[model samples]
Target: MDDPKNARRSDSLDLAYNAALTKLDVATCEAMAVSQAIDVENSELHLGFSVQIFKKLCSHSVALICAVPRSRWVKSEFENWDFACAAGQSRAIIEGFLLFLYLSQTPSCNAEWTAKLLVLYVNDCTRRAKMMANVKAVDAAEDWMRQAEELKDRLKLNPWFLNLDGKTQKRCLAGDHLMISSRDEILELAGWEKAEFYAIWDLLSQYAHVLPMSFTRMEPDGRGSGAANEADADYLTATIAWCADTLHAATNRMTAGFPSTETVRQGLDSKFEPGPKENRP
Candidate 1:
């Protein structure tokens, strides 16, 4: 016999999961519409560059959504609910959402946007240089480091970058973040409560980084193998909830530059809200 509480939880999970998938489906279609509506030639050069990055992120997001679930057993199982795998992918989606939101916003001026782009380029080059150096590719590492220096110099020349404090300039040069806003501020801008978001993010990070929570929480079934059970279901539910909310948020931001997307964005506000205050019954 099953516990009534457990059964109710399962039913709720089903409803939530279905709702999430529906939201993602709608978001995906609307995102494509926004992509199609982008008039690059007529748009500001900064917007053109930003939209290209936004389009690529959306493409990757579509792939992540499709890859989230799959059948693993022919006999009885209909899906693989590996909690670690699911959490890892969900973290990727969350991180991608941060970048997507950053790029989707319109800057005060082209110089401001250019400064942001330069920060990103410097970060990329720095990471590449480090990666090459780790593998003993001296010449490649030196080339990448040189490029990073050049980008940093150009960033310094930007009026917007020049206005930044010394600490922030150093942080940008070190490839820490592209925006002047702190990470917490960015999350708050996206409608997440600071502590609540970190709680969920930390839980996902444990699984993503393969901490003790990964194996310590597993249980053995009578068949001498671990099985997807309640906990896996919980992780999957969280993933779907977060991803669905992220997709909707990204689409909303897309509407800022692509005005045509506003029509589709309508009626979507009531769909998926991750923040505590905005959650609907």
Candidate 2:
């Protein structure tokens, strides 16, 4: 009776361990599927379409969290949880997406992208200001203003803004009171100290003039811009390369750290023939 009871308990434990492994396998598959889908959809976007795709990618990240197993095993297993990896991956994807969106053709999207970019710039400025304050630099204010001027220039040249010519550019800077006023508003809301505000302003001004022309110079029609097509293809290729490299590194790490399960070891050995052994004296 006691022996039978022990066997039943061992069998139950085995079943539970198998079920946990199956769950992890399923979650990994789901994560791979989502990653592949994002890679495919990323190729379909023109400049302005990235925002939408980024949002979709983030949503998928949330879904990925539910598929991971709940048990605590090793540190690596915790790190490999679908939610943790997805969150980090989503941030990288969003940043790349925004970089592409910054190259869009429409004025409205350009303005929106510019605004978003300013938020990041101002945040950086805030950090710099705190640092300058700590060090008490005498020339901090002057340096900040120069940075702001540079930013202003760059903002004007950003691809979405349609690269205004020399006369128009000067005229817009001088006559566009709304742009000036909006900059003030943004500065106030961003809560940067004086030096930081100058830094952000200069940086944005400089960013305004660098036109983002596509290398491919594709004809503009409903079929999509050639530059965008080429860009998408290049991005997809890079993403696949990254994924492959990551997969290889992960496999190597796992192999080095842990012995393979019996089934996996057998499968691997099945591919090779054993040679006759030589005896040494």
Candidate 3:
């Protein structure tokens, strides 16, 4: 009854759509398995191994999903593909790699290992700052200083710190004073804060769909300006890069801390927050 050409076209479209959906389904299952593995809370040894397994699963999922036609895949296909899903997958991969590095290199292994790694980065930044200060590289020093300042400001605005309010701010500031006695300490604190801020940013970025994507780089107003200055542009680039890196690292840390399926199920089973009951007669 149908024209031969139209029938062929319809069949082809259905085939493509079905194939894409099947691939997406496989990717979702793989991603969920990986998440479950990461979520298993046990000894660090077990956790670390689980995380490695999870990473392998994620790699496989990414390859499989990517092979499918992008046009056929909806946002939900990628978004709900994993624990954090595709939105946070890139960050999770980077974080897993970092954790792999830390476990292999460091003698001490604990929950705070990631924190220590951040401290090391901070120290490196500080040493560079000092070395630059001694040289006639005023421009370089100023540039570095600007980055540090931006990080500091960002840290202050971090949700974790913001949530603490008056008491936590005072305590944290006091602790900073005591802990940041040396250049190394100062650098470590900067690094730690920067890393924390980055993790928060990555998590929030998952929900960027609800936020405004457009913003003027040159002027405060939404109107498009001619262009931004070279230095300003450079600063923005560096800041964005740093934030990205920090977020990736933090995501990795959080992923490593994820609980297993059994644990999640058990927790859910153990607790129930009841809603308001209807009025009795």
Report the number of the highest-TM-score candidate.
Answer: 1
- Estimated TM-score per prediction? 0.81, 0.24, 0.24
Report every candidate's CA lDDT: 0.68, 0.36, 0.39
Q: Which residue pairs does candidate 1 place in steric collision?
A: none
lDDT of 3 by residue, 71-126 (tens): 22234343121212232433444344444444333234342343333333344455
Q: Which pairs clash in the backbone of model 3? A: 39-258, 39-259, 39-260, 40-259, 40-260, 95-252
TM-score for candidate 2, please give it: 0.24
- Candidate 3 TM-score, true structure as reference: 0.24
lDDT of 1 by residue, 1-281 (tens): 99999889879876766676566656655565566656777876656766775666556555545544431101234445566655766777787777766765678987888888899898889899999999999999999999999998898899988898999888998876666667787887788888988888888898789788777756665111235466676666667677767866766666776676566443333222221122222
lDDT minimum window of 10 residues, candidate 1: 272-281
Better of 1 and 3 by TM-score: 1
Task: In angstroms, give how far residue 188 of model 2 lies from its true place.
Answer: 24
- What lDDT does model 1 reach? 0.68
> Distance (Å) between predicted and true CA of 29, model 1?
3.2
Q: Report the poorest 10 consecutive residues by lDDT, candidate 3.
A: 272-281
